[model samples]
Structure formats: C-alpha cells, structure tokens
Target chain A: MRFRFTGIFDLFNQKNEYYLINKKLDTIIQINESMYKVLSNAKQGTELNCNEINLNTMNILIYNRVLEAIN
Target chain B: MKRDLNKPIVIHWCMNNCNKQGQIPKGVIEGKIRQAEPIKIRFINPRSQEDWRIIESFANESSDIKEIQVEYDFLEYDIKHCIDIDIEKKLIYLVAFSGTSYLDHDARNRLCNMIKKQDNFKIIVYISHKNIAESVCFIQSVYNEVKQGEFIIKPEKNIKNELTDISVLHEAISQIAELYKLFPDIKLSVYDEEKIVRDIIRLPYYMYGNMYITGDGNISMYSFMPAYNYGLSDPQVTLEEAWRKLYHEHATCDLEKILEYPRYWFKYFNRKEIK
Candidate 1:
C-alpha cells in the first residue's frame, strides 16, 4: 500500500541526524539519512511506496503515524 | 518622589499587536525614557513587513536605544547589518521562546546554534494548559543543547477564554518543581523573589513606567493594556511632552487601586479567587 506522512509529525535535523517529532503525541524518534531523504522527497498528499524506500522502514513509519497508507 | 530621568529604562515593542492593529498611539513611544538615556527595548513576535518597517524607522531615528531584544522565531531575514550596527553602538539580546508549538525541532536547533554563538541570550518557556510534560521535554532538550545563557519558565496568562484554572497554576508549579529536579540551573520568571516583593509592596511588578511601540509607530503606556494609548506621533508634541501628559492623565487613584490588587493587575499572580 502507498502511504503519506501525517500532519502531526514534524521533521528536524540535529547534529546531522534527522528526527521526527509527533507534537500531539509528544513522541520523538530518530531516522536514518536514507529514510530522511525518502520522507523529505515525498510530497504532501503523495503516496509513498517501497520503490522510494525499503519496506521495513516504510512499515515502521506507517506504524508511527509518520506515514499513512493511501491505498 | 523625584525620579531620575537619566536612569536606563525598559521598553516593549509590541509587534504582534502592531501587526494586527496596524497602528499604535504615538504618545507611548515619545516619553521621558527617550529623552533621558539609552533604553533597552524588547521586540516580541515581530515577523510581518510592517514590523520590519517600524524596526527600520527606529534604527534610523533613535540613537538612544542601548539594547535590542529579539526572539528567534520572528527572524526570517538576514539581520547581520542590524547586529553589526548594534554591536558597534549597543547590545543585542537574542531570545528563544521554548515549549510551544510555535517552533519546530529544526527551528529550535537553529535557534540553539545562534544562541550558542552569542553571549547575550535568554530562553523563555511558558507553561500552560496541559502541556507541562511537553514543556519539560522541550526545556530539557534546549538545556542539553545550550550549556550557557539564561533560562526562564513563565506561567502563561489566561485572558480571553477565562480558562484561568487553579489547576493550571498547580500544574505550572509542579512542572517547575520537576524541571528544577531535571535541570537545577533553570530559572522561574513569574514566581521569583523580586516579583513577590513587588507584589507585597503594591507596585506594578514589571513594565510599570515602560513604553510600548506598535508596528504602525503608535505608543501605549502598557503593551497589553491598549486602553491607555496616547495618540499618534505628531511633530507638534515632543515625546517627552506626550509622556508627561499620558502619565499625568492616567496615574490616578483608579490606576493606583488596580495596581494595589495583584489579582486585578498582574496576570501571573495566581490566587484561588482569580480562577
């Protein structure tokens, strides 16, 4: 299934590491550079797939609500 | 009582109000402080084009401004020239607003980096609603990032919706207590000893004789209390004259009585009856 990032998540870079913070949930998690690139490249409302990133990472992102399945 | 006119004064640049309202009373900016000595001015939430125009005018017209305090969220442009000019003449105090949804993590990191390079900086965080845990986390993150500089936690004032719950106060106190345990170096701005003393003395805790300049170049005695606006700036009336007139007109028994009761005048002062 294709997925997109949720509005509650905000991306930030610190010490060359990317972090996704869920403001409403007050949860923060660090992500790898490749994951950062994939998330950053995915446009709003655009469906994201394993073609842009690995399935395992995409699954984790979807589970965290950082990405929502579109299809 | 005779007041020293030459003494340094603090002024608030109420940019948020000015940007929203378009203009402020001119009398608020023209005051005894301007005539006496170089003043310290803090610009709050200054982001709009009108706010920048006002800042430019102040930079051009006034040589008496000794310090400029600005928050990081509002700065979108290159203010290197402004900083250079101030460094040559006065001081610039960069401030960061912590523990709010106003700034994202990237912005916070950028702010922390900027603050680390500057000697004069402060991080002012607010505790409100049910965001004590979030605030604590934000403050801890900031503390870990920036080792130097002043940190203060201010209790947010509930004005419009009248959601002034005693529980919010309790939460803020508890949050501060928790913060102290986490970061003992953190400071409390609202409940400080100096503020308590000011409350006991029946005097306005802060911004007593201060002036506030709006975006449209208007002035008021108090920033938040816009009911006391003097009027627009006029070449006919000097700032000193405006100050004298506004103070003379408003510094009455009614104002004194309001000042006497902390519950009525001070927003930070929390009492059981206030809620």
Candidate 2:
C-alpha cells in the first residue's frame, strides 16, 4: 500500500539540526539526517511503499499519525 | 493566501521621529482611505503635532479609520496633552508600557496617574530586573496607585538571542517559572481559549489581517519577518514600491516559517518532549 505523511507535521531546521513539529499536538521530535530527508519527501507528498523505508521509523511516524494510507 | 484588500484589521502606525525602519507602506493607508470601511489604527508612541497631522490627513481623506489605539511609551516621551485631546474625543484606547530601565520613578508616577484617569487603557509592566523584590515592588507600586487597573508582567531580560538557540528557550521558561512562583496571580497571555485553538489549528492569531509600519517607514506584513529594509531597497524608494517587494517576495505567514520561529511558550509547554 502507498503511504504519505499527514498534514499535522512540519519540518524545521534549528542550529543545522532537523526537527519535526506536530502542528496539532505542538510537540517536537528530532529526527536523524536520513529520517529528515524521508519525512521531507513525505511532507512534499512523495509516496512511499511500506516495505521500502525503515520499519521502525515508519512505525513511529504511523503511530504518531505522522503518516496515513494514501488509498 | 489572498487577503481582503478592503478591510485591514490593524495598522501599527509608529509615529516616532527616530529612523528605526517602518515596514508598512504609505500605499496601504492611501488604498484603505478610498474605501468606505474605516481601518483600525494603533499609533505607536505618538509625541508631536507632526504625528497628529498624519492622523488628521488620513481622517480627512476618508472615514475608513474607525478605531485608534495608542501604544504609549512613557519612558521616551513626556505625557503630552495631544493624547489627552484624542482620549477626550473618544478616539484613543491606550496601551502603556512601564518597567525597569524603561521608566524612572517620576515617569512611573505619571503613567500610574494616567491609568487612574483613563477607563480605556491597559498598562503592561515589562520586568527584566534580576532582583525579585525589585520586580514585585515595581508591579505593586503601579497597582497600589491605580487601585483598579490591570498590569501584565512581561518577563523579558532585554537580551537579543538568535531565534534558533534552544538555550534561550530554556532561559525564558526558567524566568516564567520564577515569575509564577512569586506571583501566582500573574496570567499568561496564552490563556485565551480562542488563541489556544488558533495555535492548534496553525491559524495566524497576531499576524492575521494585521500590517506594520516601523519607526523608519519600512512596511511588513508579519512582525516575525521584515520584508523591506532601507539597506536593500533604494534610498528614495516610496512605501508603495517597497510594499510591492514585500508582496512578491514573501508569504505573509508561511506555516513552515511560523513553526520554525521561537515560540518559547510552546517549548515551555512541551519541555520534556522537545529533545
């Protein structure tokens, strides 16, 4: 199934570090450089195959409503 | 997003002589004057007839100006009778500032007296002093004299910090905590239910439908980001031309930009989870 990040998240770069802010929950979670790239893509509506991305990262994003099924 | 050109919620009109850079265009006023609906104007620290003349000129052009508020900076200028004239005319709602280093004893007394006299004004006391006793005393003195007026304590240390610095957020949270401990009655500006909901929805609260004119005649749509600077624009460029640059170059309130800006209260709220 194809998936994309929800609208509740936004990307920010503070002090050369990438952080994801949940606009709905007003929470911040720092993500690694690679994770940042993936999420940035997701934010731009890039679709991801469930098996392609890191499972743990996908699980966290899905669990937090950061990602939702495209279908 | 396209804003309703007809109605501008507020115009921050800085009437000071100092060349501090106003970001709102003269064209905004000129454009708004042609409309029937009067725009609200907040006069920032108006001190002279020159400022009043500007107000009169706008008033003469159109009846589009419905409300006027004065941000009275008591420290910089004396209590002028021109303000009294407007207040008497029911044309002014006052927002006065008083605090350490900003207001001397005599000035504080003058501010307090004005507050007591006016029924339509709020006094904001910015507390930046290290001594808690001194801070409390400053607040008490104002309250004691006025007897029935509200004063907001803005705990700012007068230090400029890069917006990206997390340490600054920590310092702000600590200061707020200190204030809460001493003055439990002190209210946070964020307690407004509407504003809370707006923040959650990522809607613009302060910057929504408002524009600014800085002291030096620079025009900006958002206070967080300045669109025009005299250094970048030509020295003889008109505010109309400057405003065009702002309109083309910047989004009024980009969500990514707003999220990136340092909202210390958000950090304070999600302190444990921010890392």
lDDT of 1 at B36: 42
Tens-digit lDDT track of model 2 for B1-275:
12223223345666564444543444444343233232456667666665655554554443534555556665655545443444344444444443444566787677777677776556554443343345456655555556655554453422332322557545544654665565566433312222232354343112233455666555565333343453323435544444455655653344234454345333233234323
Residue ranges of candidate 1 with Cα displaced over 4 Å: A1-71, B1-8, B16-38, B49-64, B71-91, B94-98, B102-105, B158-163, B191-208, B215-219, B224-226, B252-254, B259-275
Off by over 4 Å in 2: A1-71, B1-7, B20-38, B56-62, B84-89, B93-98, B102-106, B127-135, B155-158, B161-201, B204-208, B229-248, B252-255, B262-275
Candidate 2 structure lDDT = 0.50
**How many residue pairs clash in model 2?**
13
lDDT by residue for model 1 (B27-130), tens:
34434334544345566666666555555555556464545556444235444533445442333454544355556677666667756776656666655665
RMSD of each: 20.9, 14.6
Q: After superposition, how far is residue B89 of candidate 2 from its true place, in Å?
A: 4.6
lDDT for model 1: 0.52
The lDDT of each candidate is 0.52, 0.50
lDDT of 2 by residue, A13-42 (tens): 544455565432223455567777777888
TM-score winner among the candidates?
Answer: 1
